[model samples]
Target chain A: EAEVAQSPRYKITEKSQAVAFWCDPISGHATLYWYRQILGQGPELLVQFQDESVVDDSQLPKDRFSAERLKGVDSTLKIQPAELGDSAMYLCASSSNQQGPYGYTFGSGTRLTVV
Target chain B: AQRVTQPEKLLSVFKGAPVELKCNYSYSGSPELFWYVQYSRQRLQLLLRHISRESIKGFTADLNKGETSFHLKKPFAQEEDSAMYYCALSSFGNTPLVFGKGTRLSVIA
Candidate 1:
């Protein structure tokens, strides 16, 4: 099965450091998403991208977090001055349609830990 | 605001027993409901969706509009069924999904 690829399966950084995660969505998928999943919580949307444009980022902490999907394919998410509270599993997902039977396909995720 | 509520943090059931994971949602617009599962050491994946109305891995969920509920059900649970299940909701168009905290199902032998 085609899978969404993510890098740096696990990362640990000191507080206030910068961290970046990469994601390569399944081929032909147009919509990509970034989500943060805390220890005991479900994944929460951080941003959504349609092709190369950001569709929604209302929940993203713009002061420290940023995401970009250039060329409407692979994408990257970055956090500067990462805080302890920012430690979580960052998951990337992609889907072909706004709504469909397949729904979203998720990556294995990058587990972040801030010391 | 679009929100999903999964009341139980965890549920334990014996093998061969019926299983049910409750989910409720609050959405102003027409909603699309989905159930996503994450197995140990595996990536999260789509288990089923209300629109498809199909049973996946012997599991099925029916969307209830009047009660605003979409509960996952299985007649007989298996050890392999143990995993974390999340209930998600989405509005029309390219809107992002709003997920409930999730329920960890532990099917005991």
Candidate 2:
């Protein structure tokens, strides 16, 4: 079974530093999403990309957060000048537009801690 | 905006005991619900969806539109069922999956 791939399983950074997380969605999937999950809470959508174009980013903090899917196959999420509150697990998920029984496949996520 | 809620943060049950994980949603239009599970040292994966109505690993959930709940139930809990289960709802196919806080189920041997 194909799965979403994410890099940097763990990261430790100081406040005000820039951090980036990468994700390669399942092949041929038309939709990809980036979510932030605080401990004990559900994953919150940060951004959504539809075949390289951003579809929804209302919740994304544009001042410090930016995401790109130049090729649509892989996407990258970046946070500049990170704050302590920005520390959380960043998850990537993908799904086909076909509306199959199986909805979305999520990655293990990148655990980030900022001091 | 679509939202999912999993009220139970932790649930403990003995082996062979019945178990239920509660989930409720807030959505306007017809909604799609799903349950995803993550075991220790493993990736989050799909467990089952309400549309299929098929029981995976003897676990089943029925979507109740009147109550706005989709609770997962298992007749016999197993130790392997110990994992973080998340309930999700997708209101629009063009949007992302909205997830709940998740329930941690521990089946004691």
Candidate 3:
């Protein structure tokens, strides 16, 4: 089955350091999402992209976090000056369209730990 | 604000027994609800959705707007059913999904 791909399954960084994660959604998916999941907590949406354009980033921390989907096919999420509280699993998901029988397919996630 | 709530964080049941994972949502509009499952060492995947109204792998979820609940149920649990289940909701106006904390179901044989 086609699945969402993510890189750097695990990362350990010092506070204030930089970190970048990548995700490649399933082919032909129009919507992509970035979610941050802290231990013992639910995943929170940081950003949503629709065909290379950001549809929503209301919950994204603009000052420290930046995400891009230049071609609408693959996406990258970066955190400059990472904080200890920023440690969590970064999950990327994709959907074929706005709605259907199918729902989102999430990646295994990249676990980032900032010391 | 739209939100999802899964009351129990951990649920333990024996194999061949019934299982139920409760979920509630705080939304005021027509909503699209979904149940997602993540097994050990696996990525999260869709389990079922309210729109389809079809049972999958002996699992079923009914969306109750009046009570703002979408509970997942299975008549008999299997060892393979041990996993983390999340309840998510998508509002009528937005495509972004709001997920609950999740319930970790452990089927002990």
Judging by DockQ against the true structure, name the best candidate: 1
Off by over 4 Å in 2: none
Per residue, candidate 1 scores C-alpha lDDT tens digits across A75-104 of 999999899999999999999974432568
Supply every candidate's count of residue pairs whose N, Cα or C atoms clash at under 3 angstroms. 0, 0, 0
For candidate 2, lDDT tens digit of each residue in A77-102? 99998999998999999888785326
TM-score of chain A of each: 0.96, 0.96, 0.96
Ordered list by lDDT, greatest first: 1, 3, 2
Per-residue lDDT tens digits for candidate 1, residues B14-88, read 999999999999997789999999999999988998888899999999999999999999999999999999999
**What are the per-residue Cα lDDT tens digits for candidate 2 across B14-74?**
9999999999999989998999899998988889989899999999999999999999999
- Residue B12 error for model 2, in Å? 0.6
The lDDT for every candidate, in the order shown, is: 0.94, 0.91, 0.92
Ten-residue segment with the worst summed lDDT in candidate 2 chain B?
B89-98
Model 1 residue runs over 4 Å out of place are A98-101
- DockQ each candidate and list the results: 0.67, 0.66, 0.60
Winner on DockQ (1 vs 2)? 1
Candidate 3, A39-93: lDDT as tens digits: 9888899999989999999999999999999999999999998999999999999
Give candidate 3 misplaced runs (Cα > 4 Å). A98-101
CAPRI class assigned to model 3 = medium
RMSD of each: 1.2, 1.3, 1.4
Q: Is the docking of candidate 1 incorrect, acceptable, medium or high quality?
A: medium
